[model samples]
Target: MQITQKIPPFLERNLGNVLIIAFLAILYIPILLYWYDGWLNKSINIEHEYFSHALIGFPYATYLIFGKNRHQWQKLPNKNHPLGGFLLALGLAFYITGSAELVAISFPIIITGVMLWLKGMPGLRLNGFPLLLILLATPNSIPYLLTPYTLPLQKFIAAMAGFLLQQLRVNSQVDGIYLYVNNIPVEVAPYCAGLKMLFTSLYVSLLLLHWTGKISDRGRVITLLSGALIISTLANIIRNTLLAVFHGNGQHKAFEILHDGWGGDIYSTGMLIVIIGLNWSLDRFEESSMIISDEKDDNFNE
Candidate 1:
């Protein structure tokens, strides 16, 4: 008699999913780790820290895919189609080229292909918010694209900070992107032009519009996005003002802590909290206006 083995029922049932997951892990894990290294330890400029915002993207995407939305993912239909096969094939071809840039480019194509192949075209098109999140989170050469604008912003920050310092009775002057605080020249380098903070805030604002269902309200979305941009700009101006005061007035240690240590993180976290508070305030204001409008309509109907 031939020897036989029994497969665990659960394992047998989920074998396809397991295989797909394993294949993805092998294909994507290296790339993901590479990105992780860049985000945390190897920014293009240690001072600018632009790529660090990508650090927020992965965790948030995971939560979107498998947290409260887990059931939605579970309900998707699994199907096999040639379009999916073509995408997968294309993504794989790109991956094997041994070019990091090409691999980065292929990342979303692979995600789309996988979604279509596993969940059908309808699922890919209709229930694809998670895909958009992943795409947004994917770090790119955006910092490079934004480089030219940094000088103008740097000038703005220096001027604004100089004004704030004068209000505080501190003698400050701005020359282009350089601020003379206590007659000590402090340059507002492009690296510390707050590009990362501004970029991250804009991104997080878009995510908020989607998460809070504010995207459906086009006017409110525009207002909120504009608010986010303004808040980021103001926050950066304040941060640089403080830094100018600290560094120009012989508080070098304090300036270093704020610029290169946990102080910076605390300030950034505070900025994000403020943005969230803005979102909450807008929501409450909108609800109150709706309530008043409904009351007016009721009186009209009477």
Candidate 2:
């Protein structure tokens, strides 16, 4: 009789990765349970799910960018093996919640899991762990490390907006995080911090890079992201100033209504407008550079 040997591949060799993932998975259950309790206790709201909820957009984004290129989502051997077990375990847990919202919310996670099992691409794999941790982590958390950058951006915007108002001789003063104008004070709350727009603009910039295929280098990506961050911060400053101006003119109640309720939607729409304009500007700059490059090459050949 002959004995046959079996071997695991490179991904399996990264046992540390697997162990870290497993540890994260183990941590997620307690986190989710706590978050569920908070939700039941009303300490958290739907907006708290913003970080987790945006994940639903990820699949759509991937589809938009990579669907046309069949090889983009390359499949690896045994990718689907763990998927069945995952669904069986998670599906049963969700069935207990029995809320339409929970089910609807979990649906994206389910699709994300299925897609990952079907394709083991690098970006998708990285996205999977974070999504899974967040799905499992209670309160569907955002990391604290991200807060520093967000806070600074918000303060900077508030300052800039206040300066612009002052420049217009509209009587505005920036006191720490508060913007006082015409005897009305608007606190630069965490919500107005421009974090959402910063992230959204960055995501859009990445999408733009993919579409144009003209700036794939790491340095270029960083430059584009830096531009996005700066532009987003400035745009938010302008937005805050506009809101303050409106509020100063006895539109306080109306602005508050929009700010607390539909503020993100409004800001997002405005950010999209500004980002589109910036994109057009960047396109023109790139075209001019290309023209110059072509002329230089022609002269060199001469």
Candidate 3:
């Protein structure tokens, strides 16, 4: 005799929504109490920097999960798993012992736990990317890690700008993070280290990777992200060089135009376009390679 398993009442109906709402409530109440101050501070800090662009990840993730994966939600099964309880406990422990940043970071784990507890592994797998996107919205306290890299990046940008100026027949000297052009000083500040651009580019790359449905291969995803980082860094160097050259020439208006306002927007828009183009080109190349491989396999069979 064959036996059939019965679908639980909750799983038979709406699978993703109920768990998602419960997960949100679980995360929000604690976050409001523990991490609110840090969250506010981080928001204020990013307001003046390109890090503000990170805010887009939240709504983008929402649309990606609900809008793009509506069918997957219906297919998800509701099953209570012990692993979920373990993860929830682990997240709470981390929150209690750790700093506010840790609490913010724990959101993904806690939410994952809630999903597992309510719907099990299938649901977690289905919504994994969206959960990861939540990290981008979390407050980060990375100054300790960022500080060491800042000076080197500053020096590198200044050196590259000086080299570019020299190529243009301009007499330039690099003094650490400062470039002296025709006896005019231009400092490459920490904010110019391209960290904000790097973060923003990485998030954008992830979004593109998901939207392109190229997230299946771990290797390709890593390659795309590394390329995005390189592109963003190079773009920032070029922008800095241009600003420095304008400053050196005593073109104060040009410097102001590029350093802020519309000029800055143009620079960022150009970088985003380049990143998107490169990712799209790579995706097409991958698809072509796969098609060629399938053809070769058919020829071998014949």
Error of 3 at 192 (Å): 1.1
Q: Which digits, one per residue and each the tens of the lDDT, describe model 2 over residues 221-273?
A: 78677888887878778778888887877886768765654664666667766
Q: How many pairs of residues collide in each model? A: 0, 2, 0
Please list all clashing residue pairs in model 2, or write none if there are none: 31-138, 32-138
Compared with the true structure, what per-residue lDDT tens digits does model 3 show for residues 1-302? Answer: 99999878877575566666775677566654334443334434442244455456767767866787767766766688999999888887777776766676677778788778867888788788888887665666674357666898899988988888888888788899998878889899887778777877888888888877787879879998999989988988888888888888899999998886578767877898899999988978988999999999999999
Q: Rate the local accuracy (lDDT) of all candidates.
A: 0.79, 0.61, 0.77
Candidate ordering by TM-score (highest first): 1, 3, 2
Which regions of candidate 3 deviate over 4 angstroms? 1-43, 47-53, 82-103, 106-109, 286-302
What C-alpha lDDT does candidate 1 achieve relative to the native structure? 0.79
Scored by lDDT, the top model is: 1
Regarding TM-score, does 1 or 3 come out ahead? 1
C-alpha TM-score for every candidate: 0.86, 0.61, 0.73
lDDT of 1 by residue, 37-101 (tens): 75665443443246466677666766766575657656767676678889989988988997765
Which residue pairs collide in model 1, if any?
A: none
Segments in model 1 whose C-alpha atoms lie over 4 Å from true places? 1-10, 30-34, 37-49, 67-83
